[model samples]
Target chain A: MSDPVISVAGIGKEYVLGVSMSGNMLREQIASGVRKIFQRVERPNRQQQRFWALKDVSFRVDQGEVVGVIGHNGAGKSTLLKVLSEITEPSTGEIRVRGRIASLLEVGTGFHPELSGRENIYLNGAILGMTRSEISRKFDEIVAFSGVERFLETPVKRFSSGMYVRLAFSVAAHLEPEILVIDEVLAVGDLEFQKRCLGKMGDVARSGRTVLFVSHNMTAIHDLCERSLLLNHGELVADGATGDVINGYLSGLNTDASIKRKVSNDADAWVTDVRLIYEGSESRQGFKMGQSLCVEISYETKKKVEHLGFGISIEDCIQSTRVFASVSSIHGIQLENVEGEGRARVCFPDLKLVPGRYMVTITLNAKSFQYDRLEGVRILDVLGQDELGTGWVLSRQRNGVVWLNHEWLLDGRQ
Target chain B: MSSAETTEMPERIIRPKTGLIGVNFRELWRFRELFFFLSWRDVLIRYKQTALGVLWVILQPLTSVVVFTVIFGKMANLDSHGTPYPLITLAALIPWQMFSNAVGASSLSLISSANLVTKIYFPRLIIPLSSTLGTLVDSLVGILLLFVFIFGYLFGREFGLIEVPVGVGLHWQLVLMPIFFAYALLAAIACGLWFSALNVQYRDVKYVIPFMLRIAMLVSPVGYLSSEIPENYRLLYSINPLVGVIDGFRWSVLGSEFQPYWPGFCLGATVVLFFLVTGVMFFRNTERKFADII
Candidate 1:
């Protein structure tokens, strides 16, 4: 390789939780020093909790390479990105970079609420390392991309949450650096704005700049990145082609077969457990586009509940949009004077959802009030497919939650 | 957007560093635009939505002068070396307010601007330095009101419409007033660098600052003259850096009627320079852990 654009060598970051409370104060620091003279302790910090967010990680990326970082919540993905972007210093090892770096971990890093949108655009741009002349040159383009031209003079405090996010994201999207580090910033804004943001990211990836992307959305990672790194806990566990790495991550998650969790213990009647039945078998990992999917729920009641109903909501985890929702009462099915233990199955014959991970929330409701509700109970993974007989496979960036049933005609007739 | 060869690009290595106590002048110079914007933002927000606005700058010292003129001049009958008590009190109060406002805000600046410090990487010194610079705008306005008050009162006396005592001499000494004001700013920044760096670690430093400034006000010659201090206690009083500032202002404005105490002023200057050199070194050494702790 012709000189990697970014190189890291055995980097490790350790954090001491609630550390040096005694050292923070002058009196406490002095007192601790006096005691240390008398007591011969091996370690002065025996009580402080030391957590290694990242340990002994080494990687290198060449010029124009786009690498994806995939891991679970505490897999050290963010810590690695932070060390690369210079937001925090690592406890051990070192990093070398040959190009200018700009990382976008959060949108609108230094936005002031009291300032007008026009003033904030400049301030936020400057905070992100843009010179004044550069901001002035792109000021018009930034405003137009945000679609908030009419309210540019108004304070951002009065903006709707959607408008605020769009304006903030617009300023960040225009930054052009030799190396870009992004961390899950696409999980925001409305569906239309999200589509535009994805389009902008495509333009960035095609421009041949080195990118290090960290995200939980597998589809986005698979579609954009050619190489991937998988982290488990604080160590680098896997690194190779994107498709193989994703398979390793998914299989790692499949080790746990139970797809049920107890949400709360407050209600008189509650759901005991839940599982997905696919293709006449109990499976949480076997799902695809255009297949019959069933959600089976088991419940117990303290007293007999009249006209009991079970509700289910399928929400898009990537886009955070609700795809489908229904209750047994709405479909004219109910159990009268339900008692003891029982099972209910809700099935969709032709599941038209696009290929992506989704969250399932189940609730138990009587005629008067809700007995118990379980939110984000289980994650349902649907594998990508080519149902349309073309080269287009499903991903979060290119598709919505559900595919429409419309057809296109060459003429006015179909 | 150019796809040039990567060989020419400047390379940087990031690692945990120790014993880097000296300031990097080139890095601070490179981020000068950020400094200007931060200081401008503070000045804009300080007077935002207030009715009096910049008027409050002039009004603050004027009201203090009235109270001291009556209490110290009319009741105690303290010596002013033939100059009017009100004129001398205004000169001293001007520097006192400037010192207090700059030091107080700049000391808490790093804690208040925690969002910027934790998110971005620049010279962390910019936050405290910008806040200290923002108060200079108010100082400029106060100096204008001082000149107008002196000239307007003398004009009325010239016309014989009002009876007032003349205490100011329009001489070459007046041109040196900016030097004293600049010296007062150095004192504030010197103390602010120490307190603000400490404030990031121990949050109780926030509560200790206001109480410390209150004690500072009593020790300096704000409402009283440094000349009136007893001979036995004079040495102890001269250790206060602001005693030199107030004395310099009174000398500059009141001319030969009041002379600056050179031995005490020289001692105070020496102490401030010592604090400044040590404070910069301490702040630079401790800044590496700021992001993790804050």
Candidate 2:
């Protein structure tokens, strides 16, 4: 087999917490100098602590392989990428690569506002590691792709934010490095422009180049990368196929206790547990398309309250777009008098979400006051062929976040 | 989508190194285009929307010359070494303005470009270097204005409208003017590197710079000629790097009694060299933390 294109061994990064001085350089310099002189007489302070941002991260990727990295915020995803791209030096370990690597940590990073769009194309392109000759060769293609040809000579400060992002992304896409490193900066522009960016990235992956992608969008990760790595609190928690890694991440989220709201007195109510039920059984949060799904929320009320309201909100996890929100009052259903520990279940006959994760939020209201609202209470994963598919298998062309129920008619023509 | 399209480039290994000097000149050479663009951007932004535009460049030193001529030439009666006091101050102000402006701009370059420093990766030295180069355009304009004034003086004499005790003419030493101008830029970069690196951590440098520049102007030969200094302290005063630069400017343009003093000039050159080397070393040492702390 061919040699791996990128290799990392025992990479670790440590950052000191709150020790670096921010204000008054001259005074800080004098204080540090004095501290150095009195080092033998004094002990280190409590604030001078070291926290590792990454710990013993080791991985290898062959040439032409695309890998996705998934993690929550402060999970060391950015730190790992920064270390690999040499933005910051690691506290320990080393990395070896076998190709010219170009990282797009941000779009429009070095663009000057006063410069014209045509000038910025060359300026930003060079900052992204493209030589002058290379930018000139691809100048026409980039301008056409951005579709801002009419305003090419205008200053970037005059362009709208959407136009600016489009031009920046276009220049970045034309960079022909052997290995490309990208962060979550693709979450810009309108949906159509984002689709084009995905298409361009797909083309780059197919053209025999290595790619390392990091994002919070799990659906994009699942569609683009076959292999995945999951990081948690500065450590590599899982490494396997994309499906299994995502499953591992979701299951890990379940271990943390349910978030409880603060109770001012015995009269307040709070949500205790949340679960997803499928097929009349205790399902572990995974459901199939077209199957009946229900969100069960358990809560307790210490004092009796009248006209208490219960509601559920479901949001598409990948897009972070709210898909459903309804309250008991909206349906004209009001409960009166005594309340105690009980469970509220909201049912959906057909789960229209196309194979991806959805986040369920539970809310409890008493009269006009909000008693408690638990966000991201449970992550619901939906699987199977889309409901609109013609057969048991779904094609990539028909992929979307939602599966709408509709029919098409055809007419015969001469 | 063809496998044969990949260009051949050298493979690089990245690892942590603990040392004072770890410059990657090859990597810097590859990013030369970025350096050019950064300076070009600075030049464009400086003159973008002002009503006077590039005229402000010439106006800055001319205004300073007028103030100095009134205060020092008429009020204080300082010596000008056989040259007209206006010409003396203008020549010295041209180079001095470039030096001071380059230093001021470069010292603040890292802070002003905080977005690029935090989000991107390139050699950190490029920031101060490009900012220093950005002030070169104004210096060129200032130099052209000096020539215009000199020609105006010549026409006034040819028409017999004015009389002066001293002879005014260009000399062979004028060819060496570029060498001295380059020294001014080098000294600016040298001092700028020190302050810019420190300014990232302690913002006091921002307030400290303009006050420091005011004091620096008084100590240098901007208001008077180097010949005015007592013979014993001439070498001591040249220890300030700008003294050699100002002295060289007057000697190159006006000639005569303002000949270049080799001993004092060498001492000033040595001081500039010392600042340049130490400033670069300090800057490189502190650069790795800028992205994290700034």
Evaluated with TM-score, which candidate comes out highest?
Answer: 2
Per-residue lDDT over B1-294 for candidate 2, one digit per residue giving the tens place of the 0 to 100 score: 423433233456778778677666886887888888788888988998899998899788888889999999989989765567888899899889998899999999999989888777889999999988898999999889888877877888889987643536667888999999999888898999999998998888999999999999999999988878899998998899899999898888887668867799999999999999999999999888888777
User: How would the docking of model 2 be graded?
Assistant: acceptable
lDDT of each structure?
Answer: 0.83, 0.83
Residue-wise C-alpha lDDT for candidate 1, range A1-414, written one tens digit per residue: 367888888899998875473346766767778978987865746547688999999989988888999976678998888888777889998899988788888787778777789988988887777788888999999999999999998888899989999999999889887888988888789879977987888788888988899887776888789999999878998989999998887666443556444535446688887788887766665588888889988888877777689999987654455778999999888789988888899987778888877778888888878887766566788888788889789776677678878887779654
- For candidate 2, the per-residue lDDT at A101 reads 79
User: Candidate 1: misplaced stretches above 4 Å?
Assistant: A19-46, A256-414, B1-6, B161-167
Model 2, A320-380: lDDT tens digits are 5678898888888756774778777888998877776778887888778777877767888
Model 1 scores a TM of 0.80
lDDT of 1 by residue, B1-294 (tens): 344746568788988776666998997997788887788778877886689988888888888889999988889888877667878888888888888889898989997888777677778898889998888888788778788878876887799976766566475778888899888988998999999999989877888989999999888988788988987777678899999998998788878767778889998999899998998988998887777776
Q: Tell me how candidate 1 scores on lDDT.
A: 0.83
